[model samples]
Target: MPFYSCFAHSLIQNGYHYSRKSPWTASQNIAAVESLGICHSFVLHCIISSFPGLPLVNPIPTKSLEGKSLIIRVFIEQFYENLEEATIGRWLKAEGDRVGDQEPLVEIITDKITFELPAPGSGVVRSIISREKSVVPVGCVIGLLGEPDDPLPDVSAENRATLERRQREVESQALIPSPETVAPEASVSERVRDRGKVRATPAARRVARENGMDLAEVAASIGGGLIQEEDVQRWIERRGSST
Candidate 1:
């Protein structure tokens, strides 16, 4: 027979034997047996069934910028290339300050050309994102100023394309040689000729000329040959004593 049928037959035989010796009513005995069977089924299910795995949940907090009045976004100079020591002149706005639209935020000077960068809108200067003397690329944010609840202005694809074009133009200008390049124009021949004509003390000259040595050679030996009177005297004394 099937396992369940065999088990039920055994339970019926035990119940009949127990009923003959017990004084309980038929309904009460049957109810008690059914309750025991239910308990056994629950235990069996608990042992045989595998539990389902649950995934973990994480909560993240949101950032809020609510009540600020103004934010200034300082952009890099469109025409400026390298930021030399003299590029930054002065700051027109301070931290935690209020400013008007088109007001000067900073003065920048490059190669004798000075520019006053204007504020984009009227609002309090919330923060200075870039420090003084820092070199920032064109279109990079240097500061942010705006009302607290105002959403950040998006740099759209078109605006980004324009900024990139302007940046390329500025970079092309920077690639051009500056006037400082003219300072190194003196040729090697000019330097050698200048060195050959350098004046020396009489004694040094006598020693060099007598030894059939070039003054340039002597100067090259004695660290650029700025021959002092003492050097000349020493050379003369050494020459006389050597003979």
Candidate 2:
């Protein structure tokens, strides 16, 4: 079934009298003619976002324009040539929060690296369609942006087709990464060992031994996490020039 049909049915089942077609007046709002305490614009936005690449169509008529929208669609650049999918790592900004242009709102992790999704334009995050840890394709609608009072846009058929066409073009240019391009990873034990290793100058080691102090202890006491001759001297000095 079409997304609008399914959503309309749900609303109607819940006692909402959705208009059969676009109509004018608040009582004839698209989704909730008799609904109360519900932001009709937000509901419409949610429904339209559920259907990717589909225009945000408001069959209902309104007195004014649809309103300004600042959409931040997922766009894979040429640098992401071989990546087909990524997992949502985290959301730095929540829905309804104001965001500055180019500010990172969400973190997405691919096989190679974790990157932040920057805001396309300064606006509020009206909706977060993509949830954390959900892996999705490259060109899907991950989230929505809009002004404080901006009503949901009526996505035209032509705009929907254009978005899909662009997505296809991006996929056509995708390439597979060379095996050598993959970086070597360190195992847990290796990482622990690397962290446990103490770096100290030869003079620092001698000073530590002469003062009955271990380099490990010196490293633990110092803020740098690395032991040095001056660190040992400072430790000795702090200890009244003795062990």
Candidate 3:
């Protein structure tokens, strides 16, 4: 009989001969079987070793709710940090009220920012998720607007003009100098100052600060003399483990 030097074949043969043999280590078995193009079997062995007899099944599909009323999620401002101070003012349309397209549904304010959130389509205001004075972030669902059994009439031209005037009045009251005009020179100076200060990025600085870590600790380990996010993360992990 020709002796097969194949590890997987040898293990299979031995496994049968010694039925009561001690179980082979996963890593050893995987290394042996993997060379024989038994990738699926190797993966199954690994999974079984890690989580014995756990049922594996594909996820079921979710039922689609097509033709449902459009939901508009509003953010108070363009940035995420403003969420802490943002406020949702009184609802322009009451809950369970029908509204037309482009109708002002709510007034949102953050920092010096104020704007009207318009109804995306003609629908009844089914529910309000966020109450007045509540701070909401970007992409937050503040309310649900659903299709009305009988939609309200579209806004007349005269009412549309009046609404436009109201919008203009609000815009005028909340106007602030554009960022570009207000900080053009300061922005340039800050960029130049930041470039000369250190090699670390702003994100890395933020991470270091939040973790109560000193940037100097990271500077000591990196050979390139530049502080990086990874260095900050590693420092954080080591510090956490030590504590």
Candidate 4:
């Protein structure tokens, strides 16, 4: 059965109206439906499937210009449940470039990984709202798309303020080592261990000790270098340190 048909039938069977507006929010509605033992993904799928004409996942409809055309607002889609913000790595298509539906548009980097976000629909890239390396909250508009002649829609102050707030929060948070802090795969090298000491040069050893970093860990990270002061400095940068 089609998702909307099956879901509507289930709701009707449980004494709910498909077209009637409920007092509950969307999340509340989902939760209420799930109480009937429906799978969460299935319920969410049905909700999205019901909206065939709407680009609810990534595009927001801008105010129709004289009722002629609607602009698509491109946003950073949330790929992970726990991810709230991401950095705009770079834009593949700049303003005025024609793009097809689902073409790779921009690179987005989260704490876990970097991935390309696709264009929501076919149109010319009308405006680039967020620049490269900007840290924006998920669902924040990073660009806009429409016909080449369409006027650029104004981004509301509220949305820009929200992005600013998220950036500030991220900046004020304490630094911590993330998965990217360490190399993903170990390289080929024997552990530089000798007489209960990490086999590092004097300068490397001195720098590591002063920074309170373990030289063995540094040796293991690089895999083959004879651990130099430069190596320690690079490691510090990767570790999110200013020193």
Candidate 5:
């Protein structure tokens, strides 16, 4: 009997089968198996030991892996020495939103300083473990992301805890008369654009921050004069008119 016939007989006895695209020849099937790291020596031993005159192979190629996967996770890092935890001050991108390179995904607060937490790669934000005002331990999973077409994965237990914490925070936020619930998305974009080093008094700065006005540009409206609270108001009116 031929080597292939003996191999086929052994495969049937062992309850193993091989398949490939149609129009594949016997030679093509063997080549494909060899490409997948099935060495001739191993093949002859396992599937055709009874046969004789099998050609010996020079070397066995490394196995080619299957099932490539992608992963995306955002962690709370140690921004300062001896920092143990960080607070999720706010979220810049909502769930399911696609973030590009260097884009801020969330705002984190540590030691009373706010910092932008940027995305590591361009991908869709699939899940948020921590919500605004929620505290998370350093190196914990605070968010998840993946390709736009990738299926949402089941979150880990650590993520589940953060989600629950967000729910509680939401309930607490509901008790306050905060305007964030009704703020328009455009206003949020404007706020992100307005951030940077700017010259303004604390009161004027607060007003500008509240209205999403860039103090850096708002100061130009004053022509090198002191940016007061009234100056910020005027700038807002000017911005409203320009729109």
Candidate 6:
């Protein structure tokens, strides 16, 4: 019997059956084998053994791999010890695009310089986990590659946690107000509640108090800023003019 016939017989004896109406596709075969807990490498070895010395076009490195899969995860590597985070400049290869070994896959922008990240192996890009112009920490899973129908593995737990932590830090920093942008209303109530101890120079305070004037009124006229002695004199002049 031919090798194909023997292979079919083996599958049938093992209780595995395929639809006769249409030929079984590669994906369907893989799914069936996975459901039966059959190793893919074993099946490949049988095929290779059947046809001795014939070159196979399979993307999987069968010689180097035992039971390992062809799925490859692309990580954001740290170029410098001090570079903990980086921005994803762009993806050179989109999802579903075939890439060559060591070809430029994406651009990583750091504080020091921007560089292209190379593909670790030859395969079709399965997914782009990180978005362009987004920031992710070193060691985070940025992309994935594998055969068209191959299953992708989950991102590393450690990398996911680090990415989440970095995102939270960025969000927290965004929520904080800058020193120059801080509103006067933040401390306006405290200053307003204590009119006697308003934020004004001693000379301004003495002049206003001796004239039976409220420092709070002078402070308000200057847009709730500190009441300098010159500011108080200007308010006095403006009041005299308005009267």
RMSD (Å) per prediction = 29.8, 17.6, 28.0, 15.2, 23.5, 15.0
RMSD of 1: 29.8
Stretch of 10 with least lDDT, candidate 1: 51-60
Q: How many pairs of residues in model 3 come into backbone collision?
A: 0
Candidate 2, position 202, lDDT: 86
Q: Any idea what lDDT model 5 has?
A: 0.60
Looking at model 4, residue 118 earns an lDDT score of 78
Measured by TM-score, how close is model 1 to the native structure? 0.34
**How does candidate 5 fare on TM-score?**
0.37
Clashing pairs counted in every model = 10, 4, 0, 0, 0, 0
lDDT of model 4 at residue 21?
33
| Clashing residue pairs in candidate 4 (N, C-alpha, C atoms within 3 angstroms) | none
User: Candidate 2, residues 117-222: lDDT per residue as tens digits?
Assistant: 7765456887777689987665455676666675644334423554687687877756555554544232322332453577788899899888897565566565
Task: Tell me each candidate's TM-score.
Answer: 0.34, 0.37, 0.31, 0.42, 0.37, 0.41
lDDT of 1 at 174: 93
Best by lDDT: 6
Best first by lDDT, ranked: 6, 4, 5, 2, 3, 1
Q: Which residue pairs show backbone clashes in model 3?
A: none
Model 2 poorest 10 in a row by lDDT: 26-35
> Which ten contiguous residues of candidate 4 have the minimum total lDDT?
55-64
- Could you give candidate 4's per-residue lDDT for residues 1-243 as a string of tens digits? 375577667755655554433233332344334344454233353464344442111111332123333456676766888789889998999888998767899999999999998776567888899899998877577887777765555565646765787678777763655765555453233344432445668898898889988777787778755788989888877887644
Q: Which stretches of candidate 6 lie over 4 Å from their true place?
A: 1-68, 156-158, 162-243
Task: Give a tens-digit lDDT track for model 3, residues 1-243.
Answer: 122234324545433221223443333233233223333222343343452222221112332223222332222324444344457987888888887656898888777677787764455786677788877544344665555542222223423454466567669956877777785656544543453544687888899889887776566445325678888999888888999
* lDDT for each residue of candidate 5 in 38-147, tens digit (9 for 90 to 100): 44222332243232233322121232212212335577766777776789988999988888745888999988678898875456887887789998866567887665
TM-score, candidate 3, is 0.31
Error of 5 at 32 (Å): 25
